[model samples]
Target: MATTEQGNGLAPRGTKEKLTGDRKRSDPEMNGGVPGEKPVDKYGFTGGAQQHCGESAEEIPIEVLRQREAKWLEMLNSWDKWMAKKHKKMKERCQKGVPPSLRGRAWLYLTGGKVRREQNQGKFQELDNQPGDPKWVDIIERDLHRQFPFHEMFAARGGHGQQDLLRVLKAYTLHRPEEGYCQAQAPIAAVLLMHMPAEDAFWVLVQICEKYLPGYYSAGLEAIQLDGEILYALLRRVSPVAHRHLKKHKLEPILYMTEWFMCAFSRTLPWASVLRVWDMFLCEGVKIIFRVGLVLLKSMLGSQEKLKACQGLYETMELLRAIRPQYMEEAFLVEEIIELMVSEKDIEKEHHAQLRHWKETHGDLHCKSPPRVHGAKAIMAAEPPSRQDLRQRPTFIVESPLAPQTDRVRAEASKENGKSKAEQQKTIKPPQETANPYFPPGDPSPFLNHMTVKASKESLSSAEHDTYL
Candidate 1:
């Protein structure tokens, strides 16, 4: 939304021009013409890494890292004390309102569950060093880089956030190998590291995944599924029109709210609103997530009209991401949501009867089958291509009970072809070849596979690549 000019170097376009005076100079370095020299225009500023005027590179202070660590440690310890006071004051302030800066820390403090007065200064190391089987460590290692692979905000910003996430995730995998590493946890961890220290983020996540949220990252995925069922039921009760439309279309509420509920609205809502929701979440429990889900459906009541004109679940998610309470009457809208969706009876019920009924009727909602590892497995299970089926084409890999049969057929063909070629070339010397036959003619040799080829290295022209295996 804000344009920064090239002058400021950090800002986009017109924004920088307004904020900073216009100064121009011609320099080839700015255009990446120079190989090793620091990029400079007439002002002697580099286009990439920043350097102050006439300042030399210098060593960073050892105390700085210590200070950073110490600060979080102190905050972690004081969290309980803060929350004890915070719990007493929260209800009154919610009726009033939390100050902005105070809100983020308050949310962090409560969510951290930093209750015990005793210091956990050395306990983090003790927890980290606890002996465990090395298998999860291997899994964590594989996913470490792939975790936050995208996101320009995470890219080249600083190693601090990434390093923090890696340490916490690795420690957690070591701590609870049962959950191991799930795809969704990395993005959640990245979001936490944006606001708090790595250790605090780590512990907070552990609490949420274990105590607060129901088996979210567990093998069964029971808790997240339960939450989805509850959300759907609440929506059905609160907004029957939306529910009927969604049911007719076979759309699941979890498709939109999965990220929302799992991350405590961390990824979907603005940081400020997330903080407010979290303030209540920690003081209360996971009830707030359900309440918010009801709110989202109710808010979109206008949009969900006229034969499901509402864009699918993904479009609903985009709408949530783009707008916030500030645009509307924040207090009244929040109150309306709470009044319509949340009930003491629903929140108080340990496990709702409606949820049980939904699960029983729609067993597929709870399904968290392990992903097919081999492409071949997927191909064999492919549905017969119908009007609906053809719209979603099957994978290229061969998947079938007859896959072994297909392999045997290929092997027989290879043998027959090899024998014919050998007999035909018998007049000359037969080429010394084997009948392995995985690779076809003109395939690059193993050694040449490492060599760079522009054609091969370039991304596929189409949306996807066909896999033979």
Candidate 2:
């Protein structure tokens, strides 16, 4: 609810901005900008990129970025150790915000998406290659263009961005046929596609749907309705002012929070705030979503002057739809969200109370699935059922380049060509240790057998562990 302004890593308006070489470009396609554009923002998304609301991000020194990246890289390389022993430090770093370039990989790790992909090798390719169910296919295709129509990736109808998006969505329906496809999933998938490849996006979406926010996208959407009720109850404790205002109007949380909570606020918040919120959400879990909603409501309805302007449902709804620019600022919003005292245990307590009420009134709760542990951390700790049938394929790209799948195929071909096993063995030689994918190519980094690079899925399993990390 605090409206105090602070520098959001960008300099104040009218201040002399820092100069870094001609990072400028005139290409209109430079992030879907207008033709003849010649300016570029340091964030790589403004001006020609035009990715945001035309505001230039503050110039962060390159040195500072490098140091942060290194720290994150170290944490990523040894994530299991840190998660087991140094979790506090890891959580603190994630709160500050992940480096932009590393956001995709960080998400794959934090959401345990990479591990899921590893667990069910080639599942994405299988689902994507198969023709999806007609019911979900039509719905997914119709909804794809509606997601991020302004962003360059999805700006083109049926472009690769949309194509990739279709693959992910269709794959999800095939992956979990009972749940099928939901319209809100398109925007959430679009956000993931903005960062990762189609395959990675698919797995992350799975983690989001099945792990982080269970039953939200199911046929009845009972889980989201339950969550909406939970949010309303928590608002009573979070900001009684906001709660009282809603109570006075008989306003329902479902009216405002449906899109916000379902899409992870992607369709609602400004670009910067959305990304910052996502960084925390991937690491901490769905509690961050509740915290964000509580903050936005408190900021909008916290004070008498604000409440006076929103005396009716229409006015309050409009106020939420068009939130003040200051409340949505990245620096301001994230700080307030982190400062809030909401916890997963409290949300769970409310969830149980809400479920009990639902059963007492409506009977059965009509759940298609059972209850779940809802968080990225909890997902990692739980033991998912093994799929012995799906492990036939080799590990994802993390295989050693020296012995790629291509190499294995070639060796098999040689044997078919009447070559002796001894000859094939001599030509192949023993495979050296897996090349580390965590570091730059040819960077001479030591092999962390436990480490994994999602891009190559690079992993050297000298030792066995739950995940590559």
Candidate 3:
């Protein structure tokens, strides 16, 4: 019997003939692979494609993907109309998430990145061609690979991703020489590039630094510190247990929260959560950051398991750094953050209060004073806000049968007390040192002092009335 060659070019039977024909090629890689092209996995997606933490590309269904793409295109076509009239619907969709295929375009629309790109045409190239501030250039180069090292786009040294990141950073240094560049900006820029092209990414970064979070990346980082104080106040009200634990352990918000706020949680959170946060941050403003921070703190320290696991300051810090993936489930996390009820109004009110306190202590100082470091002290021993201050602002209403005394009654009581105005003022001490180490040291203004006194009197009266009841 004659020997024959197999289809794959192997000789058949017991024949010792050397098979000499070009080996049959394997099936072309899926997703339109070309011969000799970069190797791709079984799925058609390329190596450069981003893989969200805890999620695989292959798991997504093709039909669902098509629908997402279609929905995105429809939204893009009518973006102006959607923004003007269907903003609620648009916000709802964004909250759900911008589909991966359309995320870049959606972000562009959300941030008005396209308009900024058009306005600054050729500007990035011009800046890139110039020698950036040598200091920032070196820093930007160092950070390029540090960002998204696992992702193919940024994994390679001096690759297109890095080059784009460098150009964007260098352009920013030139764009705002005073601010120069900050390390936190690298991740923010890198995340933007992952979703959009470099120019568009740069513009989006411009919107973020300039519009969304003004004064955030500047030399002083005053806004960030101020926001940290604001977050502390919110946390105290939202989750007192967690707040007390952090204070007891001396885990100042600055120790952990600086990077969280500075990078907009890009470095702290899982990629999926980060993208979802960015979606809301783009839509809702910086308030989302505060809300997210509160949720993470409450989830991490609110429970016994997490608290026990984090016994010391170092352990607590580590726990915060390696946030459990379970807490980062985007839908659940976003919903929890939304339910936090930390409105911008609340944040603004706290900001003004903090600012007033800051000014009273350090008279029109441009630079923020360093936060005081306190040793172990009774958590309750921290000075409370003056009673008079509380009376002036009845935002926190205590339900009691005793109605607030009338102005006439208050005046008569003051007269009967026979205390001079100065003596009466002396009765109300200044706002005491805050238990929160993050709170800047300050004395309450005279007006705040008066409010504190009134608040104390009202509280005492309410207590006596309750006892009578």
Error of 3 at 91 (Å): 0.7
Which tens-of-lDDT digit does each residue in 391-452 have in candidate 1? 21212222234334455556855776767666756644432322212235654223222222
TM-score of 2: 0.74
lDDT ranking from best candidate downward = 2, 3, 1
Q: Rate the local accuracy (lDDT) of all candidates.
A: 0.45, 0.69, 0.62
For residues 123-172, what per-residue lDDT tens digits would candidate 2 score against the true structure? 88888889989877876676665555556566566677789989999998
Worst lDDT 10-window in candidate 3 = 460-469
lDDT of 3 by residue, 1-469 (tens): 0112232122222233222113322333121123354543321223332335234422547667566656655665555555557777777777777666556656765666555665566887787789988777876675565565545456567677778889998999999887788767778898887766666678788877776676767655566767777888899988888888888887666666777787888766656678788887786677788889999889988866668887888888778776777777766788897788887678878988988876886556464333221100110013222222112122123333365766766786678589777887877554332221111345321122222223222221211111100
Give each model a TM-score.
0.51, 0.74, 0.65
lDDT of 2: 0.69
Reference-based TM-score, model 3: 0.65
Clashing pairs in 2: 10-58, 397-456, 398-456, 398-457, 398-458
Question: What's the true lDDT of residue 4 in model 3?
Answer: 24
